[model samples]
Target: MITGSDFYHVMTAMVPLYVAMFLAYGSVKWWKIFTPDQCSGINRFVALFAVPLLSFHFISTNDPYAMNFHFIAADTLQKIIILVALAFWSNLTRRGSLDWTITLFSLSTLPNTLVMGIPLLKGMYGDASGTLMVQIVVLQCIIWYTLMLFMFEYRGAKLLISENRGGDMVMNNGHEGGGAGEKAAAAADGKAKIMPPTSVMTRLILIMVWRKLIRNPNTYSSLIGLIWSLVSFRWHVTMPAIIAKSISILSDAGLGMAMFSLGLFMALQPRIIACGKSTAAFAMGVRFFVGPAVMAAASIVVGLRGTLLHIAIVQAALPQGIVPFVFAKEYNVHPDILSTGVIFGMLIALPFTLVYYILLGL
Candidate 1:
């Protein structure tokens, strides 16, 4: 039987591997193993193809019938509540707003289940936990992704609308252009020409959101795989074994490469550390510590057991997924903060996440 301490060791073992791999990538980059653009291309390939394929593959393998729906429901609800509470708490810090609160909370609460959680669970709990991990990932895909995109897009819209309104007010007067003497006279009157309807701004926002979301072919490929899975579909075409081999390399090697790319990006930016500290701390605290605590407490209160506890542990302990960082990058919302949060969450989650599961004795 795997003891609680053994579980801790599993987590500890994995972190060093991840850290070592990331270091290797860093070393290679420092040595000019790849140009900056090359490194970026690798990161993009991982994010767009490898990661999503892994998600689809892991999720598609499990029999949906094996999932303990009762346990899944209970654990999922607990996770969401804890997440929302953390969002509220972070808002209290005043470092982030309700919008920022939502983004941080969502990102911190949802982990990279395909990359991290499934493997960790399988290692700790064997095949029994794999199916549960799959179900948890499924829930993440449906609920977490929806919430993430909606909140991010909404926040972007809010900012854009406010700026546009202010600009319109300025341009409405003579601020756009005028003769020097007339402009000075008009400025005294504080009057300007009424600007025409640039009011289709909302449509532009929608287009921007859709364009970004669909720009990555990999995201849609995952969607395709998901549909295939749901419809009980399989392709028997004997493609070269090279395809699976390539995917394997992409999924395993790609993660560290991705992380290193993120780190280098952070290293390039000034004020990354200063801007991200508060948000990073907040996200790490909730994700590795407080979030799990909330789930554990809720589990005990509701008398959850076995597979339920295992599922909860997996879900609670997941580090933030790359998708959140992707959005942060797209929206130009403090990449340093986002990168810091990812690094911090992954690092701290190593030991504490194991402890969370061990304490549960699941």
Candidate 2:
């Protein structure tokens, strides 16, 4: 069990990160050091360099065998559950359309493993926990992201099919100007030719998904890191010191810059409550409650105990990721859910984790 002193150390260790975020919020909201749009550059700096390198470092340095399958399974299963639930809810409620479902599914499924997971788990558990967290991040980058890309391609393919059908219908309508039997023949032809068959659409979507999966930065970085780890396992191969140090410099800047940018985003984002209070509440509840609950139960089933158990639980319950928010924004899927889910999720991350920590007997 975690002692009172251990808990105190954990809480205190978290203080600096929170303080940085608060200062960022104050800088933008009060002083206007930079607009939220301007902070996009900082986010780019973190994503293109910092986070990838951070992931690369832990992944490459750790024993490839250090990563385990049960943890990945539990985590992935939780994400799949969220996706299915959101899809059902989107159609059922009609409050959040299918577009909103993708964003909310992203928010609930992918936790902020890069920025928040690294520091918090390290503080609560130990140095080893950071490595474990990165392993989880590797899983998130590879599996969860590819699934998201599939969702986007699915939506796009549906739209294309719908448009083709509509165009065919218009053609059928114009054919009515001809002889009566001609119109009937035209309608029959339109119905036959308009929508691409399901198999055809499925093939198109799969090809797009494959192209995107290959091109994703996270995919490359994670695969490379895993390869490096596996290679090093047999023969002790290492990169040149100069190059490793250069990557380290960029990786070092990731966490602080990420926290500051998060704060900057909060300040830049307009504070109007556009999304329903209930939607926001449901997102938070799924993220903070259901996620960890599922992970915790899975951890037990997988026979993870003590620190391993706590780390998995905490990682599962970490705040929503900036990466998923970026995806939502870029795709124009559900900006409201991405924006609100992230900001509000950050607001409660600490208290929510603390509650989980106590209940877990950590």
Candidate 3:
């Protein structure tokens, strides 16, 4: 029973909804209504708890009985193709290594499945759609996050080395130690100092992935939650119904507070917007339009319907995943360009994604 008008309505409503959340957070932040410690507390809560709980809840509800592994394969392949396509195009355009890698990273990564995808799906198809979003996210977590960790760590180390070398050269040679001529020489050497070798990056990425996978609180929380959900762990210790309602209310409010803190972090560093309009435009196009279009056609051709359709759209529509920015920030890739790509993807996908659901008659 869905129609184009429904699509437009849902899209319009949801965009403002998310924007309003951001605006509320921004206004409060600008007014200094919350202390830094309060904001940090929210971040910790969301990063460790609220988001993971949401993920677990979503996955638990979706039976995945009719799920198509082909859709998962298709989603993975499409992302890899887009990654290679952007990498090649960037190289052809001579967009430098850092920029090229970032272009690829932006095209392939997606936002947190829990925070962004589930809410957007729920708006389009209610609670059922939100559950499907979780399944798609689990597939993505397997491939995207694992690879992203590697990329972020390797690139970050290279940047650190480059910056340190540049600083030491300037300090040791600049002033009287070597005078102006020595400074010029050091500057030339600094210019020639390239990023570390690719194998080094590869190794660092593996190391980072291993470390995070084995010990990260976020990973552990998600894993435990999934196990609990799948195995049906619940306490018979009953509290008052009002208390349950109160807890849910508090958690929802906490989630909003956490998101606001993240928004503040994003807003304070406006330099992420400087990655050039073209990069942002290109990245957004790849993530939202090309990626989803490819997914839609592929899903139909491969006979993915119903729950699989639900799952596929969530993956197809999700903005650039947070893992990329996580890796980029941690490993120091083209953080500005990567961050800009991610932000652009999230903002644009917010409004246009409803059309995908309408196509599903949801």
TM-score of each: 0.72, 0.83, 0.68
Candidate 1 vs candidate 2: the TM-score winner is 2
Rank the candidate models, highest lDDT first: 2, 1, 3
* Residue 359 shift from truth in candidate 3, angstroms: 6.9
Clashes of 3: 8
lDDT of 2 at 142: 70
TM-score of predicted model 1?
Answer: 0.72
Q: Candidate 3 has which clashing residue pairs, if any?
A: 109-321, 110-320, 110-321, 111-320, 111-321, 150-205, 152-331, 156-331
lDDT of 2 at 4: 85
Each candidate: what lDDT? 0.59, 0.74, 0.58
- By TM-score, who's the top model here? 2
- Candidate 2 per-residue C-alpha lDDT over 140-226 given as tens digits, one digit per residue, 9 for 90 to 100: 777777778888878876775566553343234333323322322244544554443455456656777887777666677788888
lDDT of 3 by residue, 1-362 (tens): 87676566566535654664576457544776656666666667766656555454454444455454676666666666666766677567765475456646556446445666666666666665565566667765555666666555555555656675533433443443334324322444446643334454444446556867876555654565455445542432344568446545545554455455456556556554657888677767767677676666667767777756655765576777665666667655566766776566556665466556555664
Worst 10 residues of 2 by lDDT: 176-185
Task: Tell me the tens digit of each residue's lDDT in model 1 across 76-149.
Answer: 66767756676677666766474556655655466766556766776676666767767777776666665566
- Model 1 spans with C-alpha error above 4 angstroms: 1-20, 82-96, 166-208, 233-280, 297-303
Model 2: lDDT equals: 0.74
2 or 3, greater by TM-score: 2
Residue 270, candidate 1: Cα error in Å is 7.5
Worst 10 residues of 1 by lDDT: 176-185
